[model samples]
Target: TGKKYNSAAANEAEEKINIAIRVIADHVRAVAFAIADGQLPSNGGAGYVIRRILRRAIRYGFTFLETREPFINELVAVLSAQMGDFFPEIKSQQNLVTNVIREEEASFLRRLDQGLQLLDNVIAQTDGKEVAGAKAFELYDTFGFPEDLTALILKEKGLDYNKAEFDAKLKEQKDRSRLANEMTTDDWVILTEGNTESFVGYDQLENTVSITRYRKIDSKKDGVQYQLVLSATPFYPEGGGQVGDRGTLKSINETIEILDTKKENNLILHIANTLPDNVNTSFTATVDADLRDESQSNHTATHLLHQALRSILGTHVEQKGSYVGPSRLRFDFSHFAKVTDEQLQEIESFVNARIQDHLPLIERRDIPFKQAVEEGAMALFGEKYGDSVRAIKFGESMELCGGTHVKNTADIWYFKIVSEGAVAAGIRRIEAITNDAVKAHFAQQEKALEDINGLLKNPQDTLKAVVSLQDENAKLKKQLELLLRDKAKNLKGELATELQEINGVQFLAKQVDLDPTGAKDLAYELGSLGTNLFLVLATADEGKPMLTCYISKELVAEKGLNAGAVVRELGKYIQGGGGGQPFFATAGGKKVEGINDALNAAVEFVTGK
Candidate 1:
């Protein structure tokens, strides 16, 4: 009875330990959610989080479920469904998650197969000695092969591995990874007991403010810098991907420069090289009015463009990310492929249509989040939202946003897409401009056109002038090709006469004054002359040797000669390599000096002498 009681007690303790471990894993999962909510993962940190979660889930599955197959996808579905309300991004991007996980699993499986093959090859070459598991583990980790798979393969080959050494190497890699990615956060310093950051820039450019708490931080690049907090700031902090506002703050007696404004942990951080000598004194904050207006115009234009894309492309488009600044605005969205030129033209036209309409900007503050969405306001992916939200609306475009916008769309004189390209596999980006930027862009275009017209002697019909020049260029190119073809035909006859007979086989080797394309044509022409023809042609064009080799069907079968292999071998003489069908192959080389050697190698390959 006493022994049974001891066993029961130990069993209960083990159960508790397992429960604690599970709870810790759940908490780690929650930390991932929190980080994701802050949009920290989407830009660059997402890959690390994804790998961490996958490894954790896979390890847990192996320990508890005793299954090696990937289980993270199922777990992700459950977690995403549970947190769908808070983060709709997860729900919307569920397909993306599936694709990423499936690809990772497939990649890992392929690596395992490759590792097994490599280990088998390695063990076969080993001279009756145990292979170090550390070396095996290094291949596993570096190449994403599972260690268990390696062990099983090694066991089948009657080879032992140093398991302890393998574990040590794996642990060392984990330690280095942890040290590199570890981050620490300091406690926040409250400047004021206020909940909201008030912006007076919409109606006014200057405001009176009290000095908030400031701290010095050290970074890798910039040695030391100070971040200041203000009770109320007129300077717009960098948000919505826009660059920060620059201005000056004047106290009763002295002035301090406000270099840039940025946001951290939902708090506005004003970066400055130096602090005011009077730390407790009150000061007036002033924003660069012109910069502020230009930024606001661009911000307003971005909102219109978002609406324009939906109008032109489809309702599926949503803002993935954005940067609104005085100079320009960059917006990212979800799209399978590049926007066609026709679609871009329509999108640009739609945005300009809104600008011409001069719709009034309507901003509704402190609206319920659900109500905002129900009202057809577009919400961005990977953005965290609270119960109350700020909704910005134009005539047809509405979105939950906090960035500054123009009061009226008319203020945005014109909208132009400066650049458009892909940011990722499924994400497309557009950089655009408005107002002054558009004017400047058009001014540059006008100057360029004027210079072109001047060079053309102010041609009355630019289209006619361009067509005439194109016709002349085409004619010249055709004449040059004809001249080269005639020259090659004449040279082919001379080369045919010079063919030497070797061991009852015909051989021809020469440097032809023809391009790679033309040389290949000549070789084929010569091969069709008769059977048992072995041809090697070398040409130097633009200081590079173009080597071509051809063997007739009869000689290829009789001598077991592969022109593909021969060219690959001979190409080394010319510092290049290539392969093709048994009949024909060509190679390019940087070493023009090796053309003769390459031809000689080909002759040696064909004759077998």
Candidate 2:
């Protein structure tokens, strides 16, 4: 807090220095609070907003403060001390929040150094005082470099760019993004407006209900779609990291497939591609039982997994994000490092042990949020809780959740962690499968083992057989290299006698029977023997043609001969082009028949005919 802040030496401005201090102070609070609430800086959406704020703060420190090292993370302790009493999350998660910011600052500082070099190249290529705005935007879009930072660097060099052009490019990108995600909704067509809708999915999978209202939505992505609201529905809308339920609706006249279920403004909306023939008649709403059961298994497994992680890793671990679906479950949590292979095995074993214990689900339909928390229910930081919350518990694992779950832990036959990795600076993600997915995964693995065994000729010990085969292959490779070298040596002597004198230069152009590597070795060996020598060697291996050219340094300087230029000109015969230094070059092509023609034309470069 006592560090002095000032502008660059060239500009000794007091007001600018003060601005930098205030900017760092204000933006750091936003970053810290957001991280405590489980929002990490990333590349898109709200995550990107946090990232831009942090980078802007770091840029200020780098420019006006003249503080180049990672100093922004140091302010986190002060922020926690001042605001911790009122906002306890910052105090509890101070270390985690600090590390996330520190990583981001270090990463951006490295990029800032690279951006300076890139700007220098851009300035060198510019012939006038102005650089292209498109180039500046490319730095921002492609390389994560700030455009304003580019402008600032350019200004220091007495250069500027057209701001209007950059703004236009930015706007065009925004417009394209909006068009891709935009959708328009019409007013709800009221059918039976007096009846209120209620969700009965927790107790049943099918219920008889009537359409309360309907609306039509149009979007470029998903052309004309309809959303129908029912009087009483048994479909669970997507929320609490669980996917929406899918099923169908049937009336006396027609049947409509419900593609998905979602909630908006506390109203359950059933999405369908077409409207039913009789919206006024009573209909049977059925939720897909198989899909619902699979989702429930995964959703319940997440709770058990959360408990296992906290028990093994530490109490500091908190849920950042999750996705529970019919196929797999992905859980993101805050941790300082990678979950090691040993820890992952323990976590998996813990969850599977709970499944074997056959703990029954203890669900409370409605309870006061305060009372629920007082009873030691784990509430996620970012989620907004109302006056009442639904609590789900399985043995010692309890959390305030709105997602559907299984009746007992035994419903989850087995739990398997397939992968664990880091998604962001301090966030780790674990992807796992359960029930039918675990069965399929093991079956596929067994089949792969069988294939490997067959490839090894059903050996008594598969691993030993594989090791022996690898050793034999290595020995064969060495023998092949020796044979190729001998062949090149034999051809070298025969080709030396065939060299012809052209313009006081020793020249030879021929197609060799050896491979590309052998031809290159033979050309280099012949070139070392004499001065003013020019060589062109061509080889074809499996229908692919390779042309190698080597020119002596004396001839390259005296006769203006370039092996690169020569190969480029002659490569047209084989429909290929390549270039290298003035002394040596190589080209490859698809047309093997053109090898002889390319070799025949090499004499013109030496004779100028």
Candidate 3:
């Protein structure tokens, strides 16, 4: 690679720098959009994918463009400006996106430095020109330092980190991550042929169906399992956040247990434990009716929760994701802050009022997707839409949905929030339960209230009683602090007596009985009394070691004594590390017994011996 010293020369070179710039721009926009969608760079999950994308672009710039400075952050504004129309969120979240990118850039640079230093250290020990891959993998796993960056730097120094060994390490990590989602599936063996499978679970719980094809699978998580595809089956495949229906397949004397129903491509696969005896015989596919009923209620409640969230949190709120189970439903939406208690109460009331209204479910199928949208039906952002779509409506709440729902809102019984929290930046999640689960929630609440009342000796007003007890606790804490301060004042005298002179420097080291802040106050008071003083205080705090260092302003200028350096050096004895300004510093550590050693070390700092 040639280094172009001038701007015009760089453009004249063209391919290297220009291609690097284009790749960086394209990849940075992808990362920025992901962050705007509330998935930021993290060490795990989807966030890790975003991190790798950003780092790859940064590496390209470093290698091809000769970028000594971080130019990735410069691309964020360009990305936001160009892609802001369709994804206006990039512009709305520009500040966060840019700051997050800048932080990632700084972090990557720091880890790169550490990796290079590690390489230099390894090279110094062995007189060889090659570095071990284990050391490189250590940097990658522990510091998130990229192997590519390590290899590039090593090449520039005429050294190399073992690629085969590094690849093995990489493969190990990838395989471990993939194991949880792995399945060994055999090709489908057709027993009987027919058109694509059709679902009859929405209209009926049982149907006589013919087998189209079946396959066997083996997974580490679940042992040997068989997946059967049937024509005109009554098992609802999992989709749109609804759990798969479970039941049994029976034909005469044989019964095969249906474990789960899931759709792959245009095929609905019924998972079962064993295969039937006669492959050509027709079987009755039955769905668990009770489970389907509970799931339907929760699915309807999810729609209600979506509407309530949009109404309360402005019209900008949109569904990011959702999960519907028999006992609970979790709805993820786009929002910046947490929902308050009052807002939650209002949301619950809104859903219950709609339930009490008993709005009938209006369903329409075989409608154009755009036509449904034009007719005021809400569409999910990331869902793939076909030419024809299904619309589900409950009075004012209408959405493009295909999941089974209750015939009436009253079937929901009641809605209750289980928890609310942030899933990512600009995304919040609300977990809730409907119908029978709500009864369990209420019983748990009642038991909690009863326990609190009994703890307070059956107070007439439990809340007031608890508040009064809190006030009493605050008063007691204040009194205890006053006594500690008085005790510290008396101890200050003994600490002063321990002051000694070494080489015309007033040096003191002693253990005290004050909290960290109180101990610092005592050091400051003592410093005001004299000049050319070096003071160190060691105190034990709840089985942990803590120390403070203070140097007189004149001593810092004349003797060049640094409090931060001294405390950090002494902190090693206590198994801790810290730093501060030259005049004062503090540290905390795990070994309380090292407090005495830390104070003695400070004394050694003054005396040559």
The all-Cα superposition gives candidate 2 an RMSD in Å to the true structure of 6.3
Q: In what order do the candidates fall by lDDT, top score first?
A: 2, 3, 1
lDDT of 2: 0.90
- lDDT tens string, model 2, 1-609? 344555553454677787889899999999999988878899889999999999999999888777667889999999999999999989988999999999888889989887876676567568899989888887887777888888888899899987888899999999999999999999999987575999999999999999999999999999999999988899999998999999999987788999999999999999999999878899999999999999999999999999999999999898989999999999998888989999999999999999999999999968999999999999997889999999999998679999999999999999999999988888899999999999999999999989999988899998899899999999999999899999988888888899999989999999888788888888888898788899999988777888999999999999999998888778888988666788999888878889889998999998899
Estimate the TM-score for candidate 2. 0.79
Model 2 ranges off by over 4 Å: 1-3, 6-18, 65-69, 468-609
lDDT of 3 by residue, 253-339 (tens): 899999999999889999988988886898988889899999999999999999999999888687878899898999988776789
Evaluation by lDDT, superior candidate among 2 and 3 = 2
| RMSD to truth, every model | 10.0, 6.3, 6.0
Residue-level lDDT tens digits of model 1 in 1-609? 011112233576455446534643584355345433432223246645655555444444443334445444455577677877888766666555544454444444455556655675456446666788767886777776566656655776677788889888889988987766554434555556656455665567799988667787655445456788877787778877667888888887888888888887776777777778877788898988788889989888888888888777776676777888888989887665689888888889988888889899888998999999999988776677899999988997688887788888889998898789976535689999999989999999999988888887889997788788899999999998888788777777888898888866789888898888779878977887789888889999778888888889888888877787777778888888776778898877778989887777766765676
Give the whole-model CA lDDT for all candidates, comma-separated.
0.74, 0.90, 0.84
CA shift at 115, candidate 1, in angstroms? 16
Question: Each model's TM-score, in the order given?
Answer: 0.69, 0.79, 0.77
**Candidate 3 local Cα displacement, residue 194, angstroms:** 3.2
Can you list the residue pairs that collide in candidate 3?
none
